[model samples]
Structure formats: structure tokens, C-alpha cells
Target chain A: MALDKSLVSGSMTMLILKLISERDMYGYEMIDTLRQRSNHSFELKAGTLYPILHGLEEKGMVRSYDKEFAGKTRKYYSITSSGMAQLEERTKEWKEYSDAVRGVLALEVSVL
Target chain B: MMEEYIRILLEQIRCKKSHKYIESEIRSHIEDQIEENMSRGMDPETAERMAVNSMGDPVMTGTELDMIHRPQMNIKLIVMIAAISIIGVLIHSLMLHDSFLQPETEMISGHYLRDVIIGLCVMTGICFVDYSVIARFSKLIGGAIIALKILLIVKSLIEVNSAVKWIGYGGIWMSWLLFDMIYIPIFGAIVYKNSRQGRKGLIKSFMWMYIPVFLELLSANMTCALIMLISMTAQMYLAIRKGWFGESYKAAITALVSGDVATPSIAASVVKAFGSVFPTNTFNLYRDIVAGFIANDERNYITGMLRTINKAALLFGDSSSELSNSMPAADNQYMLTYINCHYGIMVGIAVCLLIGWSLFYMFRSLIKQNNQLGLIVGTGCLMIFILNLALNILINLGAFPIMECWIPFISAGGSCIVLSYALTGILLSIYRYKNVYPSDVDVKMPKLKLLLEQ
Candidate 1:
């Protein structure tokens, strides 16, 4: 099932930070990688990706630089050390919330 | 089609500086999408349409980007500068009132007030200017200032006294050379924005740094030359340490050390210049003159008078002994001493603290700047303020030899007042645009070959 837009929107920064934590990426590449990794589940829009990336940059959570690829300029974003700490905190919170949701859903399935 | 989309999208954003990078980034993304679609067997036109559509609403994206990229203003900095300028005006009026000459109090105060007003206006105007434009034309601006100084030096040689620092017409005079110190910040921008990479860039920046120093030395203005040398060298060292020129630290240090070793020859040349300006006996006379000033000799007595006044200065009220009205240049060079004598030491200390607090605030803001050019230019301005204030204060306390250095906004001179405001204006401009520019924004200048051909 495709992820809900609202759900994805709320966690977009954490997701983007997680992606860049593994490796630096340009905007188009991040969108592509994210889609492939989610098995086409999380298809982030370009408009959505850029604003989050820029916001992350302003917060010092990510840093950006320009490099040339295929004779065209591309801006790449990399997660900073502060971003790593944030990702760790967010990941722990997400795990707890997901585990609780799964526990409640399993109980309902058995009752049904 | 992509251009139209970008144009519409950019129209929604208020910041002009962010437009360049945003346009390029968005255009590149769309191009990548078009390529992907073509790889999947769609035609180019249909792919372009789909890519544009998938990017979502232009206005929403633009507005979101704008929210992150708006300019910022440091209101506290503005208030501090205003306060300092007002303090300058009041102190100058006080000095004129206490003057033994009693020269046209109204006329002189009016002139000082006018200068302060003009300075404040200039500061406000410069605050609105985009400082990146300076980076774009750093070379041209740096060269022009140097040329103008050289022209003035030539003019000074042709005139009497051979040390005419001012240029005047119709009874209006301006100390043109005093404004040359603005070049230090411009030099920072040049080194940061214009120089090429590696050893060649390092050498080029050094050459640029010394040209003004050389000119000042030639003109026999030792104080200006010394200040320029120290500030520009500090800037160059900063650039090197930041790896802005992409040179190894060891190599850069070696060059810097060699440069320092060469300074004694420069000092010798300065001494030689002074020797030519004064007779051999005058050297003995100069030593005796300095000795006299120290030993309270009647012929050179201002330092001794200042020392005595300082000893009797009260913490919060006027000193027991009245401020000497016969003190020359009391309104400009010795402003701090005048304040200590008339207003009490505590008031003088408060003024120093105010100036110090402003510098500290500015330094903190500059350190937080992500933009390298802003940091460099701002540092140059900060160095000037610190150096001038330190020298002026030291001279006032009789700890150092009295020179013509004017405390930034506290001194009572037209050019000094305007120059301080202009430097502060640049700092304000840098702070104002801190958020608008990305750290890696490219400031393009015309090619040297094209310029040469023209």
C-alpha cells in the first residue's frame, strides 16, 4: 500500500535526514533512492524535497554544496553531526510508536 | 517551458539572492526527470509536461522556500550604532564649549551635527545594499581606491608642508586619505572572492594586501600604513587558515614568515624617508622632543597635563582641576581624555563599554555567519574598530605615544565619522542578508581576458 501523504509529510525531515546520513545526495537522486528503497512506496515530490532540504540546511542539520555531474551543476546535501543526533532521537521515538500501534492492531485482529 | 515554470515560481519568492540557486536546482531536477521519462520511451515534450506537473504547485513551493530564505535584521546592532553616533555629537559639542579659543560654538557644533546626520544616513543607505555586489566588483573597487590614493599622494607632494591629508574647495575640506582604510574590508572581499587557488592565489592576495601599505609608506603616513599592514595581514592569515586559497598550512606559514622577515627592510625604508624629511640634528631634536613630552617639558606639555588631569579625575563627577582649554585637537584626537576631564572617569568608561559591547555583539554575529565572504568582510571591519579604539584609548591614557587615530564614532571629524558609519553599514548589510544567501552561492565576475580586450 502507498503511504498516506499526511503521514509522510509529518516525518519528511527525519526521513530525509536518515537518507543523507547514510550517504550524501542531490535532490533528484534522493527522490529516486527513496522510492526504490521503499519499493515504490514513498514517492517524494521535488517541491516537497527541496524545501525540507533547505530547511534542514538552515537549521544546521544538513550542509549543501554544488558539484558538476554530466556537465550540469547539481546541489548535494549531507547530514551533519547534529543531524545524526536528531535522527537517533527520532528513530527511537518512531520505533516505540510503531510497536504500540502494531500491538493494538494485533489484538484487534485476534478479537475479530 | 521549464523557464516559464521557474519564472512563475521565483515570482512568489521575495529574496532575489536565493533565486539564482533555486532556479538552477529546480531546472536541473526537471531536466533529470525529462531524461528519466525519455529512458522509459516517452517523447521529450510529453516528458517535460509530466515532470512539470509532478513538481506540484509553483506558488506553494516558492512560498515554502521563501519562508526559509528571508533576510534578517539585528535591531540591537542598529540601536547601538545610533547611540554611539549621538554620544559622538554630544561629546564634540561639549569639547567645543570647553575650548579656550571659543571658536564659533554654534557654527562648529552645527558642522559636527551635520556630519553625524550625513553619517547616519549613509549608514542606513548602505545597510540596504546587497554586500555580494562588493564581491562581484572587488577587484575594480580595490584598484580604484588605490589609484585615488596615489593621485592624492602626488597632489600632496606638489603642495606646501608636503603632508596635505585633506582635499578642499571653497573653504570645505575633507581628509581624503582617512577614508582609504575602507579598503581593508574591500581587500577582504577581494581575497575571499577573487583570488585563484593554491600558491599563485596566495601570492596574488599578498600583492593586493601590500599595495595599499606600500602607498601609505611612500606617502610617509606611518600610522595608516601600520594599521593597514596589521589588519590586512590578519585577514590574509585568516583566509589561509580557512583554506580559502587551497594551500597547505605549512607552505602558507613559510610564506607568511618570510613576509615578516622582510618587514625590517620596510621599516628601514620608513626611517630613511623620515631622515630625508628632517635634518640630522632634528633626529636628536625628535628624541629630545619625545623625552620632553615625557618629562613635562614646557614646549611639549600636553602629555604631562593629561597625566595630571587623569590622576585627579573623579569616578562619577567632574575632576577637581578644570580641563585645559589650550589642548589642541581636543575635539578629535583626544576626545576620550576630554570626556574623562569634563564628564568624569565613569562616564568615559561607560562610553568605552558601549563601544566594546557593540564590537563584541558584532563579532558574535559575524562568527555565526555561514557565508564566508560575510565573515571575512565583517572581520576586517571589526579589526579596524578594535585597532582604532585600542590606539585611541591608549593614547588618551598617556600609555602610548599620541597619534592621530580617532575613536570610531566618538571622534569629532567628518571623514572619521562617515567612515565608521560606512563600515558599520557594511556589517549591518552582511547581517541583513545572512539568511538570504546559501553558503555556496556563486558570485560571478567578468573574465579578465574579456576586460583586457575591452
Candidate 2:
């Protein structure tokens, strides 16, 4: 099922940080990687990805540079040390959040 | 067609100065999207449309992009400047206290305070505007300021050696020196903006820089002119070192060796015109005083001022106040003396430290920016402030001959207050956008020497 953008928006930065931490990726590459890794549950457009990446850069959470690839110069964003720390914290929070929701649902099913 | 769509998106991005880099990145993203769709058996046209549609609302995206690249302000610098301005006002108030009960003194005091308010308002307004926009229209601004200086020079000639730098309107002196000093930043911008245009551009930039200096000298404000010249030359040096002039030396030599009648004739005419504009008698008079070729009477005036300043510096009490009370124009030419007399040597030291602190911040901000316009304008502002403080101190110490320049913010001139604050505002404006460019380009980092073993 396709997730509503608003539902996925809160964790977008965490997802981006986690993706880039594994390897440096351009905007289009990150979008493709996120879609495949989430089993096509999450898909990001250029508009969504570029602003987040640029914001990350402004905060020094991520850094970007132009590189020649596949006969075209593309801007690639790499996770910085700050970005890794941010991702770790966000990941822990998200796990706790999902577990709480699952626990609530499981309790409701048991009551039924 | 895809390019046009991308252009439309970028046009809405407010921070258009950095559009090229953003455009390339966005263009690559769209191309990749189109390729992905086409590989799935979609036609190129359908894929292109799909890719464009998927990026979301252009306006929203543009706004977000603009926010990401917007200029960030330095608040700490602003607070420091405001605090210094308040200190300046308090010092001026204290110096004027004896005459404060007089209506005329009270009126003058009111206007000085008002000018500071108005000047700060102007400064705050300038901070919001992009400095690149200001640099873009510097030619017109510089020309208008130069014209005003010319008019003032003519007026000063009519007044006949009054040494008055301003015209009185409603009892307030509107300082021409302050207006002329502003041309330094505009001249800096012109030099830096045209830095890449080769030898001809360099000559044109220098000509623009020379106009205000020439005008300042004609008005008999030697100290102000020197301050501006030093600032302009420093900016020019930075531009040249940055390779903005782009192989200018080779072009200059080639033109000189070849019959290049244009370059040689132009140079000769410029020198001739400048020589004619500088009056010989006035030049000799000022030159003599500066070189200590002064007559006995002039030497006496110097000695008298020196004796008063020395006594004030040493006595540090009622004796200093008594000496200052006896001196003519004690507050005007004897700035350090008055401060030293009333507040003691420690206060004077604190004032010096304040001036040094401001200069330190200006240079620190200059190093933190990579933009050529910001660099040049920052350097111009830095030198103007530093030189004005230096010249005033040197004159007060009897090292340099007395010339009509204010003690920056602390001195009692309405125009001086307005202009000094206005200049500081510009410095703050430049500092606010210090990081607009990328890190390497904006900052001048030292090279780390690497060791090599054979």
C-alpha cells in the first residue's frame, strides 16, 4: 500500500540520513534506493528530496559536491558525523514509537 | 521543454544568485526520472510529463528552496555595535554637560541623539537587503555621491578657508566628507565586479576609485581622502591577488610594446588632468605642514596643543580639567585629551580597546566570507574605520598635523554620527551574508604543508 506523504514526512530526514550514511547518493539515486529498500512503500520526488538535502547541508548535517557520473555531472550528498548521530537518535525514537502503536493495536485485538 | 520548466521553478527561488548550481542539480534529477520511466516502455514525452508532474507544486518547492539558501544574520555583531553606539552617545553627553543648560547646546544635543536614531534605522533596513543588489547599482550611487562632493568643493571655495566641511541648513552641518567617504564601498564593488574583465577593466575601475579621492582632496579634507584611498587600494590589491584581473599584466605589457596609442595617450591625459585639478599653492601649504616645514607661528600652535594633551594625560585629575578648560576648541581637536581628562587614562584605554574590538570583528567577518563583492566592501569599510581612528589618535598625539576629521562616533558632529553609523550598518550588512557563498570560496583558509619522504 502507498503511504500518505504526511504520514511518512516526519521520518523523511531520518530515512535520508540512514540511506546516505551507507553510501553517498544523489537526489534521484536516494529516491530510488529508498523506494526499493522500503519495498516501494516510500517514494520521494525531487522536490521533496532536494530541499531536505540542501537543508541538511546548511545545518552541516550533510555535505554535497558535484561529481561526473554516467556522462553527466550530478550533485551527491554524503552524511556527515552530525548526520549519523541525528540518524541514530531518530532511529531509536522511531522504534519506540512503532512499538507503542503495535502494542496498542495488539491490546485492542485481545480485548475483541 | 524540460529546461523551460526547470527555469520556471528556479525563477521563483528568490535566491537567484545561486541558480546555476541548483539548475544543474534539478536538471539531472529530471533527466534521471525520464530515463527511469522510458526504460519501463514509456515514451519520452510521457516520461518527461510524468517526471515534471511528480516533483509537486512548483511554488511550494521554490519557497522551500529559497528558505534553504536565504541569508542568515549575525546577531552577536549587531548587539556589540549597538552597545558601542550607546557608549558613544553617553561620552558625547558627558562632554557637553557643562553647556547643556544653554538652549543652543540643548538643541544641538537633541539633534545629535536624533541623528543616531535615524542612522540606526537606516542600518537595520540595509541589513535585510542583499548586498549583491547594492553592488549591482554601485555605479549610479557612486556617481551621485561624487557629484555632491563636487558641489561641496565649489561651496567651500566660496566660503574662503573657513575649514568648514559642511553647509548649514537649519543650524545643522551636513557633512560633505561623510557623503564622499561612502563612495569607497561603491568603488570597491565596481573594482571587484569588473575584476575579471582584464586590463581595460582594471583601468576603468581605478578611474572610478580616483574620482572621490580627487574630490576629497579638493575640499581640503586630507585625512578623509587618505582614509578612503587606503581602503580602495586594499580592495584593489585583494581583487588583483584573487586573479580577478585575469592575466592583466601580460595584456598591459603587450599594449605598451605595441603602438597601443590608446593606452599610452589615455594614461598621459589622466595624469595631466589630475595634475591640473590639484591646485599648486594649496598642495604646497598642506605639504609643508605635514613635512614639519611649518613657520614659527604654526609650530607654536602645535606646541600648545601638545602641552595641553601631555598635561591631561599625566595629571589625571583637577589639573587635567583645568588645562582642558583653558584650551580653545578643546573638545573638537582634543578628543583623546577630553576623554583622558574627564574619564582618566583607564577610560581612554577602554575606548582604544573598543576601537580595536570593532576592527577585530570587521576583519574576522571579512575572512569568513568568500563573495568578491562582500570581501571588497568589507575591506573598504574596515580600512576606513581603522584609518579614521588611527589618524585622529596620531593627530591628538602630535605625530601628524591636525586635519579636520572626527573622532568617529565619539566626536560632536551630526554628519559624523550619521555617516559613521551608516558605514557600520553596511559592514553589518556584509557580515550578515558572509556565508552566502560556499565555504572554500567564502573563506581564506591557510594551506597545510604536507611532508614528503623520498
Tell me, by TM-score, which candidate is best. 1
The CA-based lDDT of model 1 is what? 0.78
What lDDT tens digits, residue by residue, belong to model 1 across residues B1-454?
7777898889989998788878888999999999999999999899999999878888899999999888878899989988987787777766556544345434555578888888889888888988888778888888998887877766655554543466667877878545568888889888876444777788888888877777665655656776887888788888888787788888887887677556635745664556344322223433443564464556546666667677777887766533555444465667777678778899999999999999999998887677778878888899888988998888788776655687888876688888888899999999888778866656668789997999
Superposed model 2: Cα runs more than 4 Å off? A1-112, B1-43, B46-67, B99-111, B151-164, B167-173, B248-281, B291-297, B307-319, B328-333, B432-454
How well does candidate 1 match the true structure in TM-score terms? Answer: 0.85
Q: Please state the Cα-based DockQ of model 2 relative to the true two-chain complex.
A: 0.29
Best by DockQ: 1
| CAPRI band for model 2 | acceptable
DockQ of candidate 1 compared with the true complex: 0.63
Fnat, one value per model: 0.68, 0.55
lDDT of 1 at B398: 71
